[model samples]
Target: MTATTRSNEPGKRSSSGRMIARVVWMSIKLLIIPVLCVAALIVGLAIGYVVLGDKPLSDVFDFNTWKHMYDLVFAEGG
Candidate 1:
Protein backbone atom coordinates (compact mmCIF):
# COMPACT_ATOMS: atom_id res chain seq x y z
CA MET A 1 0.00 0.00 0.00
CA THR A 2 1.20 3.53 -0.83
CA ALA A 3 0.89 6.55 1.50
CA THR A 4 -1.28 9.46 0.36
CA THR A 5 -0.46 13.14 0.88
CA ARG A 6 -2.96 16.00 1.28
CA SER A 7 -2.23 19.53 0.12
CA ASN A 8 -2.74 22.56 2.41
CA GLU A 9 -4.41 24.76 -0.22
CA PRO A 10 -6.25 27.71 1.27
CA GLY A 11 -9.46 27.61 -0.80
CA LYS A 12 -9.78 23.92 -1.52
CA ARG A 13 -13.20 22.36 -1.01
CA SER A 14 -14.34 18.77 -1.42
CA SER A 15 -16.29 18.07 -4.61
CA SER A 16 -19.36 16.68 -2.84
CA GLY A 17 -19.44 19.63 -0.42
CA ARG A 18 -19.19 22.08 -3.32
CA MET A 19 -22.06 20.31 -5.13
CA ILE A 20 -24.21 20.42 -2.00
CA ALA A 21 -23.47 24.15 -1.59
CA ARG A 22 -24.42 24.83 -5.19
CA VAL A 23 -27.73 22.98 -4.82
CA VAL A 24 -28.55 24.87 -1.63
CA TRP A 25 -27.75 28.17 -3.33
CA MET A 26 -29.95 27.29 -6.29
CA SER A 27 -32.83 26.41 -3.96
CA ILE A 28 -32.56 29.80 -2.22
CA LYS A 29 -32.43 31.54 -5.60
CA LEU A 30 -35.55 29.69 -6.75
CA LEU A 31 -37.41 30.49 -3.52
CA ILE A 32 -36.58 34.23 -3.61
CA ILE A 33 -38.88 34.99 -6.58
CA PRO A 34 -42.04 33.74 -4.88
CA VAL A 35 -40.99 35.38 -1.62
CA LEU A 36 -40.57 38.71 -3.38
CA CYS A 37 -43.94 38.30 -5.12
CA VAL A 38 -45.69 37.62 -1.83
CA ALA A 39 -43.96 40.60 -0.24
CA ALA A 40 -45.09 42.82 -3.09
CA LEU A 41 -48.66 41.53 -2.74
CA ILE A 42 -48.66 42.31 0.98
CA VAL A 43 -47.29 45.79 0.30
CA GLY A 44 -49.93 46.39 -2.34
CA LEU A 45 -52.63 45.31 0.07
CA ALA A 46 -51.28 47.70 2.69
CA ILE A 47 -51.35 50.52 0.17
CA GLY A 48 -54.93 49.63 -0.74
CA TYR A 49 -55.90 49.62 2.92
CA VAL A 50 -54.48 53.11 3.32
CA VAL A 51 -56.23 54.24 0.16
CA LEU A 52 -59.57 52.89 1.42
CA GLY A 53 -59.01 53.93 5.03
CA ASP A 54 -62.65 54.02 6.19
CA LYS A 55 -63.60 50.70 4.57
CA PRO A 56 -63.29 47.17 5.97
CA LEU A 57 -59.86 45.52 5.80
CA SER A 58 -61.19 42.92 3.37
CA ASP A 59 -62.23 45.68 1.02
CA VAL A 60 -58.60 46.29 0.14
CA PHE A 61 -58.80 43.16 -2.01
CA ASP A 62 -61.80 44.43 -3.96
CA PHE A 63 -61.25 44.80 -7.70
CA ASN A 64 -63.11 48.09 -7.73
CA THR A 65 -60.68 49.61 -5.27
CA TRP A 66 -57.72 48.57 -7.39
CA LYS A 67 -59.38 49.89 -10.51
CA HIS A 68 -60.14 53.22 -8.89
CA MET A 69 -56.58 53.55 -7.64
CA TYR A 70 -55.20 52.68 -11.04
CA ASP A 71 -57.37 55.24 -12.72
CA LEU A 72 -56.42 57.95 -10.25
CA VAL A 73 -52.75 57.27 -10.77
CA PHE A 74 -52.90 57.03 -14.56
CA ALA A 75 -55.67 59.43 -15.53
CA GLU A 76 -54.74 61.90 -18.26
CA GLY A 77 -54.76 65.57 -17.30
CA GLY A 78 -57.01 67.70 -19.52
Candidate 2:
Protein backbone atom coordinates (compact mmCIF):
# COMPACT_ATOMS: atom_id res chain seq x y z
CA MET A 1 0.00 0.00 0.00
CA THR A 2 1.01 3.62 -0.60
CA ALA A 3 2.02 5.91 2.29
CA THR A 4 -1.27 7.89 1.87
CA THR A 5 -3.44 4.78 2.12
CA ARG A 6 -1.54 3.60 5.23
CA SER A 7 -1.99 6.94 6.90
CA ASN A 8 -5.72 7.04 6.02
CA GLU A 9 -6.28 3.69 7.76
CA PRO A 10 -5.05 5.10 11.06
CA GLY A 11 -7.23 8.18 10.61
CA LYS A 12 -10.34 6.06 10.17
CA ARG A 13 -9.44 3.99 13.25
CA SER A 14 -8.90 7.13 15.27
CA SER A 15 -12.29 8.52 14.19
CA SER A 16 -14.04 5.44 15.51
CA GLY A 17 -11.97 5.59 18.68
CA ARG A 18 -13.06 9.18 19.22
CA MET A 19 -16.70 8.21 18.79
CA ILE A 20 -16.33 5.44 21.36
CA ALA A 21 -14.63 7.79 23.79
CA ARG A 22 -17.45 10.33 23.40
CA VAL A 23 -20.08 7.68 24.06
CA VAL A 24 -18.30 6.43 27.17
CA TRP A 25 -17.92 9.96 28.54
CA MET A 26 -21.59 10.69 27.96
CA SER A 27 -22.58 7.44 29.66
CA ILE A 28 -20.44 8.24 32.68
CA LYS A 29 -21.98 11.70 32.99
CA LEU A 30 -25.48 10.18 32.79
CA LEU A 31 -24.66 7.69 35.57
CA ILE A 32 -22.90 10.30 37.70
CA ILE A 33 -25.79 12.76 37.99
CA PRO A 34 -28.07 10.39 39.89
CA VAL A 35 -25.23 9.05 41.99
CA LEU A 36 -24.19 12.52 43.07
CA CYS A 37 -27.78 13.49 43.83
CA VAL A 38 -28.30 10.43 46.02
CA ALA A 39 -25.03 11.06 47.80
CA ALA A 40 -25.98 14.63 48.53
CA LEU A 41 -29.40 13.56 49.81
CA ILE A 42 -27.96 10.89 52.11
CA VAL A 43 -25.47 13.34 53.52
CA GLY A 44 -28.17 15.93 54.02
CA LEU A 45 -30.42 13.49 55.86
CA ALA A 46 -27.62 12.25 58.06
CA ILE A 47 -26.62 15.75 59.05
CA GLY A 48 -30.30 16.61 59.57
CA TYR A 49 -30.72 13.69 61.97
CA VAL A 50 -27.68 14.69 64.00
CA VAL A 51 -28.75 18.30 64.35
CA LEU A 52 -32.37 17.43 65.18
CA GLY A 53 -31.11 15.58 68.25
CA ASP A 54 -33.45 15.00 71.19
CA LYS A 55 -36.75 15.76 69.44
CA PRO A 56 -39.93 13.80 70.21
CA LEU A 57 -41.06 11.05 67.86
CA SER A 58 -44.07 13.10 66.67
CA ASP A 59 -41.94 16.19 66.17
CA VAL A 60 -39.51 14.26 64.01
CA PHE A 61 -42.08 14.20 61.22
CA ASP A 62 -42.90 17.89 61.41
CA PHE A 63 -41.73 20.42 58.79
CA ASN A 64 -40.32 22.75 61.39
CA THR A 65 -38.37 19.86 62.83
CA TRP A 66 -36.67 19.31 59.47
CA LYS A 67 -36.17 23.04 58.97
CA HIS A 68 -34.56 23.34 62.37
CA MET A 69 -32.53 20.25 61.71
CA TYR A 70 -31.28 21.66 58.42
CA ASP A 71 -30.46 24.96 60.02
CA LEU A 72 -28.58 23.42 62.89
CA VAL A 73 -26.50 21.11 60.80
CA PHE A 74 -25.72 23.72 58.16
CA ALA A 75 -25.50 26.71 60.46
CA GLU A 76 -22.30 28.00 62.05
CA GLY A 77 -21.05 25.96 65.11
CA GLY A 78 -23.48 23.13 64.22
- TM-score winner: 1
Each prediction's number of clashing residue pairs: 0, 0
Structure candidate 2, residue pairs in collision? none
Q: What is the lDDT of residue 23 in candidate 2?
A: 100
lDDT of each: 0.86, 0.74
lDDT of 1 by residue, 1-78 (tens): 999988779799888989999999999999999999999998877776777676677767788988998999999999
Runs with alpha carbons beyond 4 Å of true place in candidate 2: 1-5, 8-13, 54-78
Q: In model 1, which runs have C-alpha deviations exceeding 4 angstroms?
A: 54-78
Lowest lDDT 10-residue stretch of candidate 2: 52-61
TM-score against native, each model: 0.60, 0.49
Task: Give the distance in Å from residue 28's predicted Cα in candidate 1 to where it truly belongs.
Answer: 1.3
